[model samples]
Target: MDYVSALLPPVVMAAFFIALVVTIVKSQGGANKAKEDAAVDAALSRAESARQSQP
Candidate 1:
C-alpha cells in the first residue's frame, strides 16, 4: 500500500503529460496551418521592415 501510494502520483502525472503532448501534436498543421503560417510571416515581415528603417 505504501509503494502504491508513492507511485500513484507519478503515474497520474505521466498520464496527463502524455495527453498534453498528444493534444499539441495533433493540433499542428491542420486547418489552422495556413493561418498560423501567415501570422508568422506577417510578424517576420514587420520586424524586417522595422529593422531596415532603423539604420
Candidate 2:
C-alpha cells in the first residue's frame, strides 16, 4: 500500500530515535560520571592557563 509504505519509514525512524535517546539518558551520571567530569575540568583548566599565558 502506498500509505503504509509512506508511513513505515517515519515509524522506523521514530523508533530508532527513541532508542538512541534512551541509551544516552541511561548512560549519564553512572560509573563514568567522575571520569567525565574530571576530563572536562582538566580541559577547562588547560584552556584557562593557555589564555592567561597569551596576555
Residue-wise C-alpha lDDT for candidate 1, range 1-55, written one tens digit per residue:
9999999999999999999999999989999899999999999999999999996
Q: For each candidate, give its TM-score against the true structure.
A: 0.83, 0.89
- Write candidate 2's Cα lDDT for 1-55 as tens digits: 9999999999999999999999999989999899999999999999999999995
Model 2 clashing residue pairs (backbone): none
The 10-residue segment with the lowest total lDDT in model 2: 46-55
lDDT of 2: 0.97
